[model samples]
Each structure stands twice: as structure tokens, then as C-alpha cells.
Target chain A: MADQYTIHFGILGCANIARKVSRAIKLAPNCTLSAIGSRSIEKASKFAKENEYPDSIKVYGSYDAVLDDPDVDAVYIPLPTSLHVKWAVLAAEKKKHVLLEKPVALNLKDLDIILEACENNGVQYMDATMWMHHPRTTQMRGFLSDAHRFGQLKAVHSVFSYLGGDDFLKNDIRVQPDLDALGALGDVGWYCIRAILWANDYEMPKAVTAWREPEYNEAGVILSCGASLRFEDGKQASFYCSFLSNLTMDISALGTRGNLRVHDFVIPFQENLGPFYVTANSGWVGMSIGCDPPPTEHLIKTDLPQEALMVMEFSKLVKNIKVNGVAPERKWTSISRKTQVVVDAVIASIGKGFVPIEIN
Target chain B: MADQYTIHFGILGCANIARKVSRAIKLAPNCTLSAIGSRSIEKASKFAKENEYPDSIKVYGSYDAVLDDPDVDAVYIPLPTSLHVKWAVLAAEKKKHVLLEKPVALNLKDLDIILEACENNGVQYMDATMWMHHPRTTQMRGFLSDAHRFGQLKAVHSVFSYLGGDDFLKNDIRVQPDLDALGALGDVGWYCIRAILWANDYEMPKAVTAWREPEYNEAGVILSCGASLRFEDGKQASFYCSFLSNLTMDISALGTRGNLRVHDFVIPFQENLGPFYVTANSGWVGMSIGCDPPPTEHLIKTDLPQEALMVMEFSKLVKNIKVNGVAPERKWTSISRKTQVVVDAVIASIGKGFVPIEIN
Candidate 1:
């Protein structure tokens, strides 16, 4: 095997997702966690010691220190929704590649800043939306587009909700009242919105109307919201997201001929369930549940840990960057723009008392 | 059994649905077809002769003549969509009950006229929305309202479409441009919209925005349209209807705990497809397909023919008209008002380029 291209990683946050990605980095074939950064040096050192990274791995007291590290080739940012653009741009300015967590930024303006900075620095930037990377999602897209079976797309309905932890109510930047004004939209709702846009082949919505309930601490910040999006082709999508409900996720697409539904759109592997399957003429040909071995009809199985799979994919992209200097696909830019538009509409609709807001 | 009240029936339209209902009326325990009316008397005579009604059963030369006969206690108005209110009122004034087709009228004004005539004449009136009488539908409602299953109602997404037939295009009242101008909404789409409202205990929508394809005939009428409805509690419903697509029907309700999805919400018995079942927590428990011994979990299985079921139910109501003075639950005045608001909003939105139309 051609010697695996080594990529050194710098993590900008020591939160749970960051730790999970750190472990994934260690497991990746061609990557290592070369640096760790946190607002507190003690936390950074403690994370390094607990994970047993070599003493050579640098621990930085601040994010900028890690960005300036000459040994790090790329930065993994699992920061709050608001700081995604800032740290991503800083890392790009230092010529380091970036794998930013979902949402990329709180708004389109911040996302544009990161995109321009990455372009100027000639670096690869990816929004780590692992759900799209899964093979079953691609299978779903194929099933929906197949004219012989699924026929013309009519409408899409998706829901992603979960009861969040008390820590979410703390001073954490993600739930911070002022910074992340739209809590669910910026955090979990982004995934559901992205899936709808992706399923529709990036067709921009002609109009959007939303209903939102703001959190108790911040009247300006949304806790849960549902949006109705109409596309130019007359197709429609209705999606819901919440931080106050127990975890429930599902997506159903209706077409001219038939329909396709996915019970869980995200995290197919942590499931102790059977293989997640898709059927065309026969609706929902049995999907396996909770930690069962793959059934005979199982099309795709994510036996690997989710974080590890994402890290593996990120490592491949970094290698491609080194070999070809090619930038990652620009799809993320379109997705980011659409997501911000939805977030803006949700917030605006709440202010306007849930009236339909046209997307120009 | 107290001499089952035999209701002598007269059918005004000789379409496929009319034939089905006609046969169902013959099989009903307390109903018998006494007359057949068609613009062509020869065709009406032939239909009555083939159905083997008594020789005394009249073949009316015109629909008005059938209403003029005092022997006919009820009239099944299955005529063109535009003629529903005209004949309904005429029959009611002549002291006859009415089982009007799916939509009661072209709009609320016409519906009001029909209701007023029925009230003034002391006769039973019902919009023959057959799906409501399906056993499975009642069972579905039970599951949704079950406190142990779905807790607080949250959202609803529904769709119903069917490819139009040549005959449906030729003589079907739905294609007449003016009478059925709001194409899909009045046809199959109304079922989805009504089902949502019914599931929520008739909690009307607070606002609506809709879009429709503007295909006008000489009389200037819409052929297809879709709408989004917003309810007071932040719950929402999105529905689509079209005359150009093949059959596809589904309704899903999401609640605080679990959810319910009905694959074939309408016409579940036609193709032998039992309403396929699934829940958020339980996954696909089993199929509701094929009528044999009937599954124990099955909440509704009506061996009675569709038209016969409606006739039987309506006969019971008509028999109790004097004792109960028209059961309040059987009338749809309030629901019709709410539906008309949505219909008007949809028409306005389509005309105004999908601008938001708030319901009062």
C-alpha cells in the first residue's frame, strides 16, 4: 500500500464531540492528534494525558496558539455554533485545512468570511456533516431519483428532535442567549434542513414560513421550530426540530409513483439494531433494529464508529489536498447558504407571528 | 328486529362511483333503489332493468322528475361537481335526504344553501366522505389519542393523489373547470385536509399559504394546487392534490411520545393493501394486508361495501332524525366553514403568486 499520507491534527475545543473526533484521529490510518487547545491550559493538558497522546503532542492554552503551531497540518473545530467561522478563518489564515462541525457558522455572512479566507489561503474546508457521508443516504438519494420506481418527487417531511441536557442551558457558547439566538435551528435543526435541501437536489426554496418558540432565558433565541418550504418546481418540504423533546428522527419523501422513508436519518451505527434498508416498489422492506447482525437483505451497515468513519473520510480529503492541492466540493457552500436562509426565516417568522416569509 | 326501516333510494348520476353506491344500496339491510335518473331516459331504463329493481321502480326522464316523485325518500347526488348544491337543495325542498358526493359544494355559500334547505325540510344531509367510516381510520384515531402511545399532538403531514382516467377527464365533474375549479383540494386532497382537522378535534388552522398550477379552460378554473396550513398551537399540516398523478396516499402524525403513519389513508380495500403500519419506537410491527381471518391488532375491518357502509350509516341517522333531531356530530357546518377558508386562501395564493393568506 502506497505509504499512507500522514496528516497532523489540531483540535480547537476539548468538548465531548472534540474528544470523540480526537479518538477518531488517533484511529485514522494517516492522521494523529498533534495539538490540543482550550481556554484553560489545565483542561487541555488533562485531555492529552487522559487520551495518552505522546508527550510530543502540544497542548495550547488558547485556540490561536494551536493555529500557529507549525507542526499541525489541519484543525478540527467542534466549537460553538457562533465561533465556527472565527476559528476556521484563523486556522485557514495560518494555512491549515479545516473540518468544521455542522452549521459552519451562525449566519451566512460568517460562513462567507470563512469560505473567502479558505480560498485565499488555498486550503480544504469541510463541514463535518457525517450523515451525508453514510452509504445509506446515497442509496436513499438513488431510490428517490429513480424514475422507474420512485417517480417524480412531490414533497418531503423530516423531523429531528431530542431532549437536550441541562448543560445546554449553561453559559456554554452554543446555548448562549446572544451568540446563538436560534438554538435548535443553529444546532440540530441544521441537519434536518440540510437533508431536505439535499434531497431536493439543492433547489432553492421559492418561499418559506415558520413557527418558532424561543427559549426561556432568551426571548430572541428559538428553542424549537417548524418550517414549510416551497420550491420553484412547486415541490414542498415541511420540517420540525426541537431541543425539548425526546430524540425522534425520521424522513419520508412522497413521489409521483411511490414514497421513501428513513426511520433514523442520522447515527445509523451506534444502533444495536439491524441494517437500515430502503425499498422502492415495496415500501420499507424491513430494517433491522438494535445491535442485531446485518440481515440478508441489508444493503449497507455502518459497523464502524461514526466519529471514526468521519475522521477516516477527513483524512482522505487531507491526503487529496496534499497530493492534488484540490479544494473540497463547493456543495458545502450551497448547503450553508440554504441553512442560513432557513434560520433567518425561522427567526423572522417568529417575529412576524408565523407569517409566510418569501425567500428572495 | 322492529322492522328494519327500508329506505327507498333514487340515484341521480350513473358514474362508476354511482354504480358502486347503487349496488351497495341494494345490499344495505334497510335500503333499496327505487328509481334511476339520467339525462337519457333510455340509459336510465336500461340501468334499472339490469339492476332488477321492481317494474314499479321509475326511470326518470330528467333529474327534476326524480325529485318530483314522492316515493323517493332520499336522493344520492353524484352529479357533476357544479350541480351538487342545486340538486341537493331541490331534493331537500321536496322532502328528501341527501348523500352528496365527497365535496358538499363548490364553495361555502353553496354548502350553506344546501344545509339551510335540509334544516328547513327536516331531512338528513351528509357529505359522503367514505374514508371517515373506515374501521381502520377509527383505529388510527384511537392510537393517536391513546395517552400511553402518542401523548400531546404536535404535527401532521398528509398527501393524496391519483392519476386521472380518460372517463374521469371526459365526464367527471372534477374536470369541468368551474364546478371543480379547486382541482386537487376538492378531490382527494380534501380527504387529507379533513383528516388532519378531524385528528386534531376540529382545531381550525390559524393561517394558510398555498400554490397552484394555473391551467384554465374556457370557464377559467384551476386544475391542481397545494397548501400549507398553520394551526394555533404551532402544529402544522401540508397537503398536495393533483389530477395528473397516479394514486399515492399517506398521513403521518407526530406527537410528544410516539407517532402514527397510515400508508393508504384512503381506499385501503381497493387494491388489497392493508394500511401498512409503523411507529417511531416499535418500527414495522406487521402488515395490515389481505382480508382473511383478519388480524387481531386490526382495529377496523368492514366487510360491508364502501357505498353500502355509507348508506347503512346514513340510514341510521335518517331513522333517528325525529328522535334525535339530526345528531350534531353528523353535520359538518363548522368543519366546512374552516375548509372553505383554506380553499379561498389557496385560490387567492395561487392567483397572487403564492403570497401568504392568513385565515381569520
Candidate 2:
């Protein structure tokens, strides 16, 4: 029943996140899960069975087998941050399109190496930030772009935090230096940084300064942190990410003419609809006792989950490159690198005693 | 039919804010608008007529006459910032309970002078920050204090801004160096600093740092600015106040177990009720695609307006001093001084090129 345009996908890990992505691949009409691989054959087989993959899906004991599968047109790499460079580079070298998990690499240096491999192999590359593909995000963008609705942006503040309980603090790979060294900043701060950049049209900040007194685990992995970014035109953005607070994902962007607030930016409160609030040309009423027109709430409905839309979008790009003989889209790669640049600057600023790091 | 405990209030200066506070005094059950004074007798008489004050109200050509009135148990001074030290101190010295408008004084030094005058004369002193008396504010404090619902506070962010338009930027007393001097910071930022301190239970931040590139008028009065504050317990707060943006007032407080968001902190979107959002012990659900429990919106209804409540509270203090022979309430003076201390530090930080200013 598979169409000729459907991209055959291979998943290169049995991580918990892979379960969600596997479902997304199934939901995406242009993508089909062809194979899955893990270090342990039994684990891969069990994951396929538990996730209800059909008999046509292939199971392999090693990630290399998935990359080597000639039938696979693309690979979704959800391995740990430390393992991304090794598997993603190899997948790209094998001419399979790559969908890499975030904090894509430990630093920009490692990310550059992986990006270079994809460029050389002419493989489509994109990071798996699902929220970017949401229909609500597009709606919010339209408001921000309209000069009458939202004029020149003046400031943006975002917060992405959740109380990752005792078990996560002690045993999670995210808190382990060898696996996800950046910890909360990498795991949660990545989305905050990405949201800031996305709101700013991917323009890199002129400078980045990390807030002082970041909390760290015994392993020296950051448990919570915040940073401020300053753009060239005096526009500013600040974000806080933590594994020690209640669940909150908020983005408040203030412009000359309008204000936009999305309380559930990284993840919506409901799966089917995402809501955002916007107020344009708002002013005071009745001796400054109340506002004339309060912020209006707009809810966007989606037929499929945001993650599936991400997969569908990536697969469309892959199909264009494979079936139409076109080059891979460069937009995703550019924005991903820009986000990593700010992350690196924040880390650098923290390293140097909370001093501001100049961006070039 | 006036009660024996009713406090008679005389307002000094016919500033725009006085119009609202004058109405509030009439609305307050235990207060009566007995007198009003401006530099021009016609202006004072016209304001009394326009605001529909009772026939018994007195109109004086000079603020000194209002302060000199023996029947005026309390004097509300809505004079400009530069004139606050003069009129407020004189009003207190005249043995009238001093209800001064904010930026209570140009600095704590001046505020101290006014406080000493009130102390030496045995009169209550309170700033005219109306929102502080809102019933919704008390409800929010309850949430922040709940150990089970909202644990130890981690961070707070507040913003207060309004587009003052070209005429205000050019001609308003707030933008004139010799009149308001502190400009937007004194007018709008005052509320933001107070909100941050209110959220932190009035615990002062040890250090304050202003953000870079504060927009200023040609007279060198701040039009917009932001600052970050760090407390001794590692709790942090940041706020932005502007006169060049759409009207927006928001406060977000994040604790270990809960998050509190108030979209309109300075003034509610509606006059009769104020709404706030809170989420306690929230977490992800169903593959981290949505939040388990969404934030609950709480609307607090108020009988009289917040400004009227403020006048009533101030009058209660005045009557206690007059009838019950109790010492003037030090709580209002203490918090007002604390707020002034932070405001002085923010201005000092900006003066020093965005360097951190230690509170001590």
C-alpha cells in the first residue's frame, strides 16, 4: 500500500524518544519506518514488537546495519548527544538523510563535523525540534511579521522548565557527563534558545551572557541555568531552563505595536489544539484602571501531531532530493547552526565567570 | 451622615493621576475628598467641577493651603517627582498623613527626609501604588506562600510598559529632567520593582544590574530600561519598563513546585475582576506531547476599585493614629523604603554603565 513517493526510513536507536518518533513516522504519509537497530538485537526486536511495527519492518542488532540497509532512504538518529557525531556522520556518509536529536553535538565543533559530512554526501539534514513544525507556530509567526499587528520586536522572554524528579536527577543519561554533558542546558535550554532564535528570525545575537549561580549536579552537569542575548538593533531575549521547577514553557515577545504570549510553546497543553494570545495597539482604559482590549486567544487545530508534521516535512525534502534530483534544503542546517552558536556562547560566558561573550 | 472615623483627604497638585485618586477618595467608605489645590485656582475649581465633587469640597489656589487645612486629616500628594520631597515633607510636617505618589522621592535620601518628617510629626506615610491593595494581589500572595502548592521561589520576571505617544515623550512632566527626572523608571518601573519585591516577600536583592542600551529622551530621561536583581538565597528577578511600547503589565513567578502568571499586574484587563494563572506540580503526559494538568485561571472579584481600597487602607491607618492613639504603621514605611532602595540601585547601575550595584 506504500506510495512511490514514500521515503523509506531507518531509526538508529531504541531510546525512549524513538518510540514517539516511530509513531510519528507511521503517522506521516510520506514516510514509512523500514528498519530499526539497537546495540542489542533482543532490545530492537522487543521495541519493534512493543511499538507494533509490521512484519515488513527490519530489525538489526547494530546501528551500522540500519545505515547500511540499501532499502532505507533516510535515518532518524535519536542516540545520546555523545553518540550523535559517530552515527549521524556514518549515516550521512552512507547517503542516507539524517534527522538528528538535539543538542545535536557537544559543541559547534562536533556539530560542524557532522554538518560537513552531510554536505559532502548531499544528504538532507534536520534537527528533531517538533514544535517548530506546529501549525500554531506558523500562526504566531504571521502575527510577529505583520507590522501593524506586531511591530519591530523589542524583547522576548522564554522559560522551559519541568521538575525532573529524584529518579531523573540521579540516574538519567541527561545528568550523566559522559552521555549528555550539557545536562539541563542541553536537554531543556536547547528549546528555549531555539525559541528565542525562532522569534528573532534566526538572527544571531551580538552578545550572550549567562546568568550567574547556575545549579549543577555532582557530576558537574548543569541542572538549571539562564542566559540573556542582545541583538545588534537593541532587541533582546532572555531564557531560563531548569530540571528543578514545575512544568512551564512560555514565550512572551513584546513589540512596539503588539504583544504575543504562548504559555505552552515547547509542548501544548492539549495535543489537538495550540493556543496563543496576542494584543495589538492595546492601551489603557478608564483612568488607567483597565486595558481597553485585552489579549485575544487564538487556537490552532492540527490533524496530526506536531512530531508527525516534522517527519512529513523532512521526508518531503528527502523525496525532492532523491526523486527530483534537487539539492537538500539549507534552511534547517543554517538555523540549527545559529542556535548551537548561541548555546556555545552561553556556555563560554558561564565558563568565564558570567562575563558577556561577543558573537561574530 | 459621615461616620466619626471618616478621614478627610485633601489632594495637592492637579496632575492627571490626582483625578483618579480624588475619585477613589470619594469612593472609599471611610474617606471623603474634602479639599483640592493646584497652582491655579481656576484649575482646582474646574477639576472639582469636572470630577463632580460634592459642594462641601474646598478649592485652594496653592498646595500649601491644602496642607495647612486643619480639617484635612490626610493629604494626597500627586506632585511631580522633583516636587515630592518639598510638598510631601511639608505635608508631613503640617501633621497630615502623607499619601505621596511614586517615585516616592528622587532617592532614598530624599525619601528618608520625608519619612523623618512623618516620624517627627507622628503621621502615617504611604505611597499611592493602588494595585498593591487589590484583593487579587492578596490571593496571589497566598499561592506564593503555599509550601505544598508553590515551593521555594526560584525566579520572577515582571514587565510594565505603555506607549506614551509623541506628545507625552516631548511634553509630559515625566520626560522632563527638571520635573520627574527619573522618567519611565520612576513612573512605570516603580510598579515593576514593587511587584518583584512583593513576590519575594519584600526580601531585597543583594545586587542589581541594569540592561544595556536604555532608550532615553533628548532631555536624558529614561524612556525604557530593564534590570536584573540577585538575592542572597540565589532567587533572582528581572523586569523591563518602557514608555515606548504597547501597554503591557505582566508578572511571572516560578517556584520549585508551581508557576504563577499574572498578565495584568499593574492594572487588570477588566475593572471588576483580576485573573491570574497558576500551575502546581505540573508535568508532561503521553510521550511528553502535552502537559498533564494545565494551568488553572483564577479570577478575583473586587467590590470597590483597587485605588479605592488603597485609600480605605490608608484611611484606616490614619484613623487608628487619630482615634485609637496607636503609633503610625511602620509596615507601609518599611516596604516603601525597601522599594525605593531597589529603584536607587537600578538608577545607580545604569549610571555606572550597566555594572552591578551591591545593595549594601
Candidate 3:
């Protein structure tokens, strides 16, 4: 049943997120879950068994074994942020394509080490930001890009937050200073920052200023924070991220002629369809007591889950590089880099007494 | 048909907003539009005819004549912001309850002058923020107040904007400093600030900071602006208001256990019903790929429009004061003062190079 065009993916770590991505790999038509590796043989074996992985799937005790597998065409790195550079670069050096988890590295300096290795090895690199592959995202982008419908962009507000509860607050790796380091900003804020960038067509803000108040945990990890981004042409954006609040993911973009809002931007409430609202050319009705046209709801249906689509898209690129001799796509790497740059700026601004940090 | 309990209202100016309030007065069961006043009898007479007012409605050549009419129980002032202190004080001095349009005055100092007059005359004072009377607002407040459902507030983000277009931007009274000195901040930002305060149960923020790069008109009046408010308990709020963007009125509030959102917070899309969304205790479904318990849309129905409800509430207070000799409700005046204080602080923050202005 195996096809030559199918890309075999080896998950580098059995992190909780890997379980979802592994399912995505299985769901993707062009990819198969070839291998999984944890720190120990027992851990890897237990994970594979618990997830009901097929007997044909390889289980390796050490990550090096996964990279050494001849059939592994791509490696999905879901290691902690501090360990990303070491493992991701090793996977690229081994001639395996890299699909790294977000907050790719602790900062840009380490991220460059990973990117340079991937480029030198002639392999595709993409961050595992699953929402980018959602069909609803593309449709929303169409609305935002329309000149007559949306007009010139003026302001955007985004929020991504969820209450992690007391157990997660105390025991989660995200709250461990040395493991994730960036904490809420790296985990949830990464999504918010990516959303703002996506809305602005990947254009970097001129400057970013963090809000004055940021809640920190005992280990000095940010639990909640927010920032405002200013553009050269007067377009503005602001985002708030927290691990101390109930689940809320929203994006509100205002344009000269229209506005768009998505309440569940990070993950759709239902996997089958994603919904958004658009109000175009609205005006006052009857002495300004009410609005003329209400925002229309748009629901985009997808046969494949967004994560599966992401895996499928990544596999297509890997297949292109292997069979057709096409160069690796650079767009994914560019977006990841820009997102990390803003993340760095926000942290820097917060560190500098809430001063505005100029984007490079 | 008028009864002793019915409150008679006099319109002090023929501003465009007055058209809406006049309809509200007529729709309110306990209120009757008794008089209309402008600079000249011709303007007042023409307005009365165009609106198809009954011949029993008095047309006053001057505002003083309406104030002199002993039958008028309350004065609804939709005059320019600059004229509020003058007319509001005069109306209050005549022992007339004042229903003033927002931004109640240019600043807190001027607003205090008007408030003091109302208090001295023992007449109720209320700002014309119609959305406060929407049934949906009361329901949303119930959710926020529920300790187990919404929990303590963490953040609030609001926006109120409309594209005023070319001619309105150039010639509208809102853009004229002499007429509405606060411009978009007073006109639209008032609602956002009020919403923020309302979400926090009228607890004022400790300090406010304006975002950098506020767009301004040629007359030095702000066309678009945003600000962040920080509370003593680490709660945060931010809002954006503009005359350069599409019609958008939104309020997103995040709490420890739940979140609340409304798209059309200022004016509902449909006149008879308003909608809001609440997602309580949401969590990950299937390895965080999607959310559990999607936000439920709540459509609050109302037989009376929000403005009419506002009129009804104002008239009820007037009737209570007139019939039962009950003291004027200080709650409305206090809320208006708090909103004005925040407005003044936002302007002060913007003026001081986007510095944080402490709210005292």
C-alpha cells in the first residue's frame, strides 16, 4: 500500500503535542507516521501502545535512532524550547526535513543556528503553527485583501488566553523557566503574534511596546501579558495572551470600508467547520439608532482537519523536493522568523520598563 | 392622554442626535415630547413639521423659552460639547432633570460644573448612553458578576469606530474643535471607556496610557486613538476609537473562568434584539485540537428599543423624584463622572507624549 511519493515522518519527542501531530500525520494522505522516539525505550514503547499506533510504526528509544532511519524523510521536533536548536539542526544535518514546534528557539540567535543548518542541508523548514493551513484562514485572508470590501487596514485586536488551572500552573513545562523560558508569551502569545502578522500580510510592525503589567509566576515565567504594535503607515495592532484566563481566542480587524472578526481563531469549536463574521460598508439606520447591515457569518467547511492539512501541505513540499527537484519553500521559514523577531521585541520592551522596541 | 406620572421633556437643540432621542421620548410610555427649541422659531417649527409632530407639541423660538415652560419636567440636551456646561447648568438651575448626550463635557472639570448644578437643584442627572439600557447588557452583567461562571476579570478590550467619509470628516460638528472639542475620543471613545468601566463594575483603573501615533485632523482634534488602562488589582483594559475605520463596536472581556463578547455593543444590528457570546470553563477536546463547549450565542429580545428604554429609565427617575419626593439617583451621576474622568485622562495621556496618566 506504500507509495514512493509518500513522506515518512519521525516524531523527535513524545511530548503531549506530538500525539496530535502524529494523528495528523496518519490522517494526511501523503504522509505516514514512520517513527517515534522518547528519552527512553520504555517511554517510547508505552506512548506508541497507549496511542494505539500500528505495529508497523517504528519505536526508537533515543531520538538519534529516529534520525538515523533511512525511511524517515521528515522529522517533527516537539522538544522543549531550550533543546530545539540542538535537535532541529541535527535532524537537518542528517538530511531530514524539519517541522519544528513553535517558539522555535529561545531567541533569534538560536533560531538562526537551526535555520542556517536547514538551508545548508537543502531541506524544507516549517514551524508547526497548524492554523495557517486552515481553509477558513485562507477565506478570511481573501476578505482582508479585498480593496473594495475591506479597504485600507486601520486597527486590529487579537487575544489568545486559557486558564491552565493550579496543577498546570505549578507543574507544566511551560511554567518551568528553563524549559519554555518565554512561558505564556511563547506558548499562547506566539499564536496571537502570528495572527497579527498574518492579518497585516506578514508586514513587520515599526515598533512594539509591551503593556506595563505582566503577571509572573514563582519561577519568573510570564503568566499574562499584552503589547501594542505600531506601523509606519499608521496601521495599529494589539494583542493579549494569558495562561491565567479562560479560553478565548479572537481577532478583530478594522478596515476603512469593512471589518472582520473571528471568535475562535486558534482552534475551531468544531473540527468540521470554522466560522467568522464580516460586516462590509455598514452604516447607521434610522437616525443612527441602529446599524444598517449586520455582520454576516461565514462558515468554511473542511474535509481534513487543519492539522492534517498542515501535514499534507508539508508532505507535498517534501515530495516536490525529492521527486521533482524543486527548491525548498522559504515562505514558512520567513514567517517563523518574523514572528520570533516580534516575540523578542516584546520581551525586550517588557524588560526595558515598557519602552517601545524598534523592529529590525 | 398624558397623566400626572408622565414626564414631559424639552429638546434644547436640534442636533442630529436629537432626532433619535425625540423618537425615543415618544416611544417611552412614561415620557412625552412637550417642546422643541432652537435659535429661531423657523428652525424649530420646520423640525416639528418634518418629524410630523402633533400640533400640541410646543415650538420655542429660544431655548430659554423651553426652560421657562413650567410644564417641562426634564431637558434633553444634545448641544455641542462646548455648550454643555452653559445649558446644562441653566437647565439644572431651573430645577429640570438633565439627560445630557455623551461625552457629557469636554473634561471632568466642566462636567463637575454641570453635576454640581444638578445636585444643588436636587434634579437627576444622566448621560444619554443608550446601550446601558439594552437588556443584553444587563444579562451580560449577570454573567460577569457570577463568581463561579465568569470569575475575576483579567482583561477587557473594546472598540467603537465608523468611517465618517470625506464630507463628514471635513465638515461634521464632531471634527470641529469649537463644537465638539474632544472629537472622536468624546463621540465614540466614550462608549468604549464606559463599557470597560461597566465590565469592572464601575471600578476605576489606577492609570491610563495612550497608544503612540494617534491620527489627528487638521483642527488638532483626534480622528483616531487608543489607550490602555491598568487597575490596582492587575486587571487591564484597552480600547480603540476612530473616525477613519469601518463601523465596528465590540467588547471582549476575559476572566479567570469565562469570557464575554459582543459585536454591536453600542447599537445592535437588529433593533428588537441584541446578541452576545459567552464561553464558560472551556477546555481542549482531543489533545487540544479543538475546544469543548463552543461559545453560546445569546439573543436578548426587547419589545422597546434600547434608546426608548433609556428614555423610560430616565423618566422613571424623574417621576420618582416628582411623585414620591425620593432623592435623585446619584448612581447615574457617579458613573458619568467616572467615564468623564477616564476621558480626561486619555486626553492628558495623549498630550503628554503617550505617558501614563494617573486617575485621581
Candidate 2 has a TM-score of: 0.98
Top candidate (lDDT): 3
Which candidate do you rate higher for DockQ, 1 or 2? 2
lDDT of 3 at A15: 93
Docking class of 3: high
Q: State which docking tier applies to candidate 1.
A: incorrect
CA lDDT, candidate 2, residue A71: 95
iRMSD for each candidate structure, in the order shown: 14.3, 1.1, 0.8
Predicted candidate 3 versus true structure: per-residue lDDT over A1-360, tens digit per residue:
559999999998889999999989989999999999989989999999989999999999999999999999999999999999999999999999999998798999999999999999999999999999999999999999999989989999999999998989878989899899999999999999999999999999999999988998888999999999998778899999999999999999999999999988889999979999999999998888789689899999999999999999999999999999999999999999999999999999999999989987
Lowest summed lDDT window (length 10), candidate 2 chain B:
B228-237
lDDT score for candidate 3 against the true structure: 0.94
* Segments of candidate 3 deviating more than 4 angstroms: none
Identify the superior model by DockQ, candidate 1 or candidate 3: 3
Per-residue C-alpha lDDT of model 2 across residues A73-129, encoded as one tens digit per residue: 999998889999999999999999999999898999999999999999999999999
- Span of ten consecutive residues with least summed lDDT in model 3 chain A: A285-294
